[model samples]
Target: MFHTILSQLVGTAIALFARVVTAVRGVWQGVEPVPRQRVYFANHTSNGDFVLIWTVLPPALRARTRPVAAADYWLTGKLKTFIGREVFNSVLIDRNPQTRREDPIVQMVTALDDGASLILFPEGTRNMTDQTLLPFKPGLYHLAQKRPDVEIVPTWIDNLTSVMPKGKIIPVPLLCSVTFGAPLEVIEGEDKAKFLARAEAALAALAQEVAR
Candidate 1:
């Protein structure tokens, strides 16, 4: 009961805050926001990227979308733990595990198998530069291989890097747009490096669209 109430409150807060402070605009290309099993991948610029993405989603869809996050960061404090588990329904993973047996991919695949959409940061960490994006990590490729049927969509969050630049706690009020590009295609038996490169290019193209 408490978790349900917290989730509702968090939803309301994000809806209002996103509209009032950020004036966030959402653009969909080649696909519309609907209740579909998908993996929404994006470039990680700020710690709040998932929040912003979750905020922009349509309410019903928002309820079903879960953000993939790091357990160490979100599980550190009581308030954060509640928000991460209850509010956002995040699939928190141990990025730096002590043993090789601890795999984040297993967690992500489990979420997909349970019929939940995911919000992922392919970059793995926050970017410090002004470039469109840093190189994407291999987790995305592995995840794709695991869940081949799920749609992989490339999303870009513009101006977020400046809104809450890395290492800064306070967010600057700014206008940012979240553009959801078309689903990325998975070729038959594609190599890891080649697939990752294509995925990076797809996101970069969306960023370019935002710039225009």
Candidate 2:
């Protein structure tokens, strides 16, 4: 369809632009990016985090990766809604605690059930500093439990916090790097807290590695 073509075109353009703007360096620590279902979870620090992550992925893999974003933000305007839904193939969810028509967990589970890999920020919101990450929510734990076969890849992005700081409007060009660490394993009979702690540690370790 026209929309699908347009989406791919726009996505490709943005990904190209991101490469030049951020000077992104993608480092996959000995892990090959296989063509299969995966959950790409990372530390969120800026609005551009997902785009940068998508840009680092190979073109073929990028087509299958969808970022999980907030519906309230992406659905606010017509252009954003179109780009989020069509271009990025984002999985939008309602984050408002007061009003909710659908469960975010179920929605994400449905996306996996349909065979689409995801890019998720387990922190749920942007952290003030790239060095420190917020405590992860329980969503990742639940998702991992649901899809035992799907690999959950822990990613660490450096310098994005400085590129687009929390409250800044103009972005600064920086040498940002995206490091895809080893796949996270869910041990048998692991509880939510323990799994979340392990996931956080895995991501933190990658961040420290990237800092070096």
Candidate 3:
């Protein structure tokens, strides 16, 4: 009980700090901040991408949403482990197929079944290159196939890569924005390649919109 309370306090502090540092704004373009189960898939550029999304959400929705993060990174240190498991209530999945004990899709589907919305990065890993977006992995398609009823939203986070670069410990003060685009669903009989293509296009288009 004490740990739970401490976790909440830490989570609050983190969110507040993120807002103050980035001046993050939430822009709902094609959707409203309504209560519904959703998978928010965004471009992967920085590790703090999910935190910006979480911070901009309404408190009610924030309580029900969890970020999907890497197990290896989040479990390495004591503070990271506590924040990942307790504060953020993240869905940590092993990225290594050789050492993983469970399927990533199954873990995500289970989380959705339990009524928690997710913030996912279809890129599977952080984008450290010059590309606008890395080719998406098939995990997003599989999760959509398992739960077609859940809405999949395209989220575009702007200017975060500049705020906190790859290996920077302290973040720079910058204005950032989280844009939520229209929801997407896997068209009936859509092949994996096509669905992933459409999902990627949706996110890229949202980013372009934000760039305007």
Alpha-carbon deviation at 77 in model 2, angstroms: 0.6
Model 1 pairs whose backbones collide: none
* Distance from true location, Cα of 29 in model 3, Å: 0.7
Clashes of 1: 0
TM-score-best of 1 and 2: 2
Task: Assess the local accuracy of residue 197 in candidate 2 as a C-alpha lDDT between 0 and 100.
Answer: 95
- The Cα local distance difference test for each model comes to 0.87, 0.89, 0.93
Candidate 3 lDDT, tens digit per residue, 1-212? 99989998998999899999998999999899999999999998888989999999999999999999999999999999999999999999999999999888999999999999999999999999987899999998988888999999999999999998999989999999999999995599889999999999999999888898
Which of 1 and 3 is ahead in TM-score?
A: 3
Residue-wise C-alpha lDDT for candidate 2, range 1-212, written one tens digit per residue: 99888988998888887787798988889468778898989999888999998998988888888899999899999999998999999999988868879999999999999888999999998888534789999999999998989999999988887888778888887788899999987698899999999999999999888878
Pitting candidate 2 against candidate 3, the one with the higher lDDT is 3
TM-score, cand. 1 vs. native? 0.95
Candidate 2 Cα deviation (angstroms), residue 191: 0.5
**Residue 192, candidate 1: C-alpha displacement in angstroms:** 0.4
State each candidate's clash count. Answer: 0, 0, 0
Q: Ranking by lDDT, best first? A: 3, 2, 1
Candidate 2 Cα RMSD after full superposition onto the native fold (Å): 1.3
Q: What is the TM-score of each predicted model, taking all chains together?
A: 0.95, 0.96, 0.98
Among these predictions, the greatest lDDT belongs to 3
lDDT of 1: 0.87
